[model samples]
Target: MEVDHRIRVSDGDGETTAGQGGVVGVFFARCWLRLRSVLVGLWCWVAGFARKVGRIAREDPRRVAHSLKVGLALTLVSVFYYVTPLFKGFGVSTLWAVLTVVVVMEYTVGGTLSKGLNRAFATLVAGFIAVGAHQVANRCGAQGEPILLAIFVFLLASAATFSRFIPEIKARYDYGVTIFILTFSLVAVSSYRVEELIQLAHQRFSTIVIGVLTCLCTTIFVFPVWAGEDLHKLTAGNLDKLAQFLQGIGI
Candidate 1:
């Protein structure tokens, strides 16, 4: 009787141990599968990104070069602010130059030039008007200055908004008109604080010019990409594809 009892107890213990081992094995197997699935997803993303980069390099090398040039130009402009004392007085406004670069730089040379020139010209004209308006308002005394300035902003903005819709101007100078409105608003509104409008305008203008010149020089000198060239190539390629399709259809 005692020997039978001992054998039964031993068998029960062995069964429990085996069951625990099986559960542990299954848990580890599930963990490994989850980890493997995550790794595979990450690898697929990396592969897709690499393939896209490869396609861009093979199909549009100029685009790649232009991107690099833009990056270099931004870096150079940033370095100027950090290293040059001339930019120190600009305070937080120094970032305007960087913003200008980002806004003005285009994939094509002519587009960059057109946009940059427009921005510079608009800012110049707006700055002068803002300064003059502020000076005139100041002569009207504090009580009347706000009213006069408000009226001036309203009139100028209305005119600019209307002018933006003109066909010839819309085609080219729309961006300039937008910038003019923006500059005028900024300068005119800030003038009430008695901040030196002329100095502020000069700094903004100089930084913008720097950004524009940097972009223009880098794009023009470094394996320039012309909008006209890209348009021509695209047109030719489309025509050829159409011809091939028509031939395939026996049309």
Candidate 2:
């Protein structure tokens, strides 16, 4: 009977099976082979998520509805790119509208409305403030522009952050405030170098508006889930539970 034995490989030997010398080389060669196997089998994971995002996309009816809704919204917004007149009107900035639809579309009407309105109002306010800040920064001259912009960003961002601590603002407008700071910072910084800040802002803002409108329409009209209705139901449920408890005490 012969025993299977590892071949004696030395540091300088060229006869190793992996074509590399010694134990270290053999270990690394085996690890590389294992990594290749993982990469080769990755298609299994990708294929699962490749299901068409249309009506009745999945077994779950709710999930299927959501998928179809999202697909419809995406398709509607994509018209900006497909139609020649719309594409010409918006130019490359049409892409922003598509991105906004993807980002702002939500599962509930309240969620969609909250985010869409927040983003729209924040962008409007930030765009105006950014333009004003840019004008002021311009007067500071090239050397002073960067410094002034940085200072404005720092002060405003800090103030916005502090505002988030208030209970009223935190309950609502939290997302809007965050977006406000983001838009302001981006515009303020970009204005220093980009010559067409005003034009770029206008295009971006317009696209965002379109995106917000699309989200609002799809979430509200397609398969409406009213936030107020949910809140009312919840309140009613709690009242019923309280009444049941009092009835038990009376008995």
Candidate 3:
């Protein structure tokens, strides 16, 4: 009887150990499968991205050239941060030029030119107006300054918003008007907090102008792309095709 009991206990221990081993094996297999799937997904994503870029380059090699131009422009502008002498006195304001390069750089030379001019003019106009508003607010004393600034912001913002509804302005100067509102609000609201508001405005505006100039030069001198020329060519090609079709149809 004692021998039988010992054999049964040994059998139970072996079964329990085998069950635990099976569970561990299954868990590792599942983990390996998940890991493999993740690796395959990453590989697929990289391959897909490469194919798309290659397709784009093949479709229009000009796009790749334009991309290079943008990179070169950004590199040129970034030099402002690297060279101490070149960017002396500008300090952190140099970043504004970088931001300008990012936002103002367009696919076409004409678009870049238009945006750059609009930004410059808008910043200039808004700075002057903000300074004027600040001066008026100051006369009202410290307590009244914030109140007046808020009111100015509200009124100018409202007017700018309303101007967007006008068809003429919407078509021609919408971007400029929007930028003007932003610049004015920023300069006007911060005037009370900043003692040397003029200097601050000057730094920001100067940096932005530098960035705009960088974009303009890079776009024009380095394989210029013109939307107008492309449009003209496309229209001419379509007309030619239409004429050919009409002749073939005996029209």
TM-score of each: 0.80, 0.69, 0.85
Report the lDDT tens digits of candidate 2 across residue range 169-238: 9899898999899989988988988898889899889999999898888877887777788789899999
Model 1 per-residue lDDT at 223: 88
Error of 1 at 18 (Å): 7.0
Given candidate 1, what's the lDDT at residue 215?
92
The number of the candidate with the highest lDDT is 3
Query: What clash pairs does model 2 have?
Result: none
Q: Write the per-residue lDDT of candidate 3 for residues 1-251, one digit (tens) a residue.
A: 35322211236446323345566777999999999999999999999999999998998888988889889988998998999986786777899899888888999999999989988999899999999999999999999999999999999999999999999989878888988999999899889889999898998899889999999999999999999899999999999999999999999
Q: What is the lDDT of residue 202 in candidate 2?
A: 94
Task: Name the candidate, 1 or 3, with the larger lDDT value.
Answer: 3
Q: Which of the two, 1 or 3, has more TM-score?
A: 3
Task: Report the Cα lDDT for candidate 3.
Answer: 0.90
Model 1: residue 183 alpha-carbon error in angstroms: 1.1
Backbone collisions counted per model: 0, 0, 0
